[model samples]
Target: MPALSPTMEEGNIVKWLKKEGDTVNVGDALCEIETDKAVVTMESSDEGILAKILVEEGSKNVRLGSLIGLLVEEGQDWKQVEIPADVGVPSSVASPTPAPTPAAPSVSAPPKLQHQPGKLQVRLSPAARNILETHGLDPSNVTPTGPRGIFTKEDALKLLQEKQKGKPSELKPVVSPAPAAVPSPSQATAVTSYSRPAIPPISTPGQPAAVGTFTEIPASNIRRVIAKRLTESKTTIPHAYAAADCAIDAVLKLRKELAKDDIKVSVNDFIIKATAVTLKQMPDVNVTWDGEACRRLQSIDISIAVATDRGLITPIIKDAAAKGIKEIAASAKALAKKARDGKLLPEEYQGGSFSISNLGMFGISGFTAVINPPQACILAVGRARPELRVVEDEEGNEKLEQHQLMTVTLSSDGRVVDDELASKFLETLKANIENPMRLALN
Candidate 1:
């Protein structure tokens, strides 16, 4: 399992394009790995036959450098090859054993534990243990379906599922007793009622009450990664926010004029370019917080946050400060396309010195975004709306003026970018954006 991204500690095998015994050549896409940001193709580095697939597809959180599969020369009898002990396969899967029979179980009762040698020493995966404990089930009652008689989470879940199907919806404790413990006529006929806990109705105001039960949909790999990163950013980073109202009347005119020249651009493209230029001017605000030192990057790469059906991904535009307006606009379009298609390479979405998250297209007024790690700041862009303001003319007569106003919020890492530095960065950004023509030269 190779680290697909800089922030990735583990990767999920989305799918394997090649199966065991398939021929592989250099540059061949061996599998798709779901990383922290996007699904990337893992290419084979050498020509060989796929000898084995040790980790199954859809297996998640496999550690970096863990053995995922093997490659061998042609006609090498790959079947005879021995798998390493540390290849991550559980011992139970490596060697199968028959499940021990319940010694004192009644004919019609659930499986019961018996005093057997090594029974108390059964090995279980963390997932299996958690599942067993959560469902109030016992590992001894679950049949070992993993290699070397190891109890696996899948085995526990299977038992629980089967029990749910055979028994009541409410799980009951499995008691080891004789089948003849059946109650007599009057005892069996006794009325019993269970008091159910009050359930709060799930509904929206002004809407009709819900009539049907809603099913829980498991989060996708991308959604899970988003949740984890957002949580970590909020919990670990000491974030300082600074907001500024910028007049974008000049930018609006510039965009229209650029369209006439066939250099079509978006507000977000301008924002990204402005951000990169400002980072170059305010180098101190572009540094990252290393545990021991402040690491300032030399390049002015900017991460542009793009929302896709899967999740949010930030594809980097490397050295945006050196690129022209047309170049930046074209690159942003291409990167956003690749991000939505899940084809962004590791280098395209990995490291950057700053980030731009634009929610203007979504009609959001303004919002403070959590900073992406290893980058000191993130610029949140809001919609440029028309607002009325009073202005004094040359004659000193007060007049109501309409201006295109936009609210932008900058979220900075307090460790590296202080309040003053963050405010200065925002000020520079506002100037470049408001001037509009200055961006063309930068």
Candidate 2:
């Protein structure tokens, strides 16, 4: 499977668009691959006949560069093509023995084990199985609490906890129970009351007790990847943050003027333009750390962080320093749409010299964003709230004036961008944003 995203090590085959023995042309979509970031269509780059389908649909975690299928030339028999034994093939297609005749039962079908009446099959989810194995519990004895009488992790955990508390399993005995051991309804209710976990009283006086049950759904691939990357970033990267309160009255004025011409612009678009100019002015801040030395990029490709249903993906606006404010605005809008739709290609989201995350539209005052790997600096944009400032009048008299103040936090990799360099970059960004007209020239 092709690595559709930068951090994608494996991909899940959501569906196959083409079947075996199909005549596939170049640029044809062979399958839909669900990567950590999105579900992307994997198009074929080479034209050939799809000879054999290896990985079946819904197969997950298919390693990158592994053989998933065969594309053979016309007039060539695909069955004659010998696959090397060392090359790992998908489990669905790899077979050592010859094919069985149609009379034989399908070997691919899963074998079902018979159970006693009213007993459930010993099927457990990954989490449930792990919990049971870890706690030395048998799956056959554990009660299935999930939908359709399937065992769930919560059921396994609750059973383990109850056993530790000296409570017997609630499952009915396979054999007939003795009459003396049978508990009455009152006794069973008392036992349940004793086994139930204690709930602390509400801190507020005269408040009703709250009751609830919760289910733990497995995390999506994107969420898991995000967790892993964020954990690594927090632990490995030495981050230093610096904040600046920018006076954006000029930007607001410019935006209003632009709106008069039917050109819509957002605070984030201005921030992106200003950041690009600042990066161009201070190239030292646009650098990444290599093990041996700091690697500085020639072009300023700014990654704009966009949150989608899958996760947060940053699509790059390449050569942002060379693009105008209007162009940046248009590109940013299109990129954000593409990101949400999961239609962005690898080159669009893979690499960048810097990143900008704007929470201003959401009315956030200020917050720091974690620096994406290989991007030395990330600028976090907050809402531009109006603040009263004391100003000098033409007569030299002091007067109060309302100005829109925007807070921006710069998170930089300490190894690549020192405090002094980061401070200079933020200062330049503030100047550019406050002046507003300077961005027009660039």
Candidate 3:
């Protein structure tokens, strides 16, 4: 299997686009692989005839560099291809020492499988083997449905489901006794006042109650990695948080003006532009924590958090300090669409100097976000709400005025960004947001 991402150690085969005996060419998609981040298509790098498949579809956690299939040169007889003894062995496993070699013969014979009497020779996929071994099931009992009588994972799951259905349920229905004579209204009232209500039986402190059945959904490769990384960030990194409320009335006005000119922009687009401008002004906040030292970045690449069906992913806007508001909006829209479609390439989502997670559209007033590792800080934006504030008029008369205010929180790694630095970053961000016309001037 190929490593689809930088941190990907293993991959799951979602499906194979090509089958055995198919003509393979350069740039032909061989299969769709589920990586630690997304589902990506694996393309062929060489021209050959697909001879054999060692690992089948639905196989998970196949290690990198492991043999998944075989390809032979064009014009060669694919049927005559020899299968290696360790076809499915992981690349990390040590190879056994070779025995003493005998003198080569002038002529070589074709390889063949050795079969014994009373033994069933069944071809089982890797996933099917795992299922059978885990349940201690006999392979001979399962009916094969794959090509050449191969027992697939689907067949194994079907057999297990059938066996479960065959077993009788242990819990029997309770038989209720006949109801007593109905009580008068007065008697019912007295009984209600004196008698305690019926309460369901509760399980013990250590054990859970058998309330309802739930389906066991397997975690996808992306979800697993997300869980691991977030856990690590929370446990290993010392995080500090700072928040500020910015008046967004000017930003909203700017959006309206831009819309009149046939240029559509969003509140998030203005925020992104403001963040890039603030990062450029304060380079100390735009840094990452290397193992040995804190490295401040020269360019400001902003990673925008996007929610997908699989999980949360961050697609980056490179050199945001140089891009205008229109360019930033277009880029964010395209990247978000690609992110939701799970079609982001490694470079599109990988590196960034900082991150921004906006829950403004979701109507979240305020929330703290976990800091993505290696990066020093992440900015969390909340929804904009109208608030009445007391302001003094030119004649020294107090009056109430309404303003659109948004709350923003910055999560920082204390080791890289101290309390003062975090406060300064938020202060600058607040200024740029409140006065968004400064973004165009910069």
Candidates in order, TM-scores: namely 0.75, 0.72, 0.72
lDDT for each residue of candidate 1 in 380-403, tens digit (9 for 90 to 100): 889989999999999999999999
Q: Write candidate 3's Cα lDDT for 110-227 as tens digits.
A: 2221122454455678877766555545555444665445678777666655554563232112346698779998788666535555333322234565565233467889999999
Question: Least lDDT summed over 10 consecutive residues: which range in candidate 3?
Answer: 108-117
Which candidate, 2 or 3, has the higher TM-score? 3
Identify the candidate with maximal lDDT: 3
Clashing pairs in 3: none
Off by over 4 Å in 3: 86-214
Which of the numbered candidates is closest to the native, going by highest TM-score? Answer: 1
Error of 3 at 319 (Å): 0.8
What is the Å distance of residue 321 in model 1 from its true position?
1.5
lDDT of 2 by residue, 218-285 (tens): 56677788888789888889999999999999988889999999999887888888898888888888
**Prediction 2 TM-score vs. true:** 0.72
What is candidate 1's TM-score against the reference? 0.75
- Candidate 2 lDDT at 104 equals 30
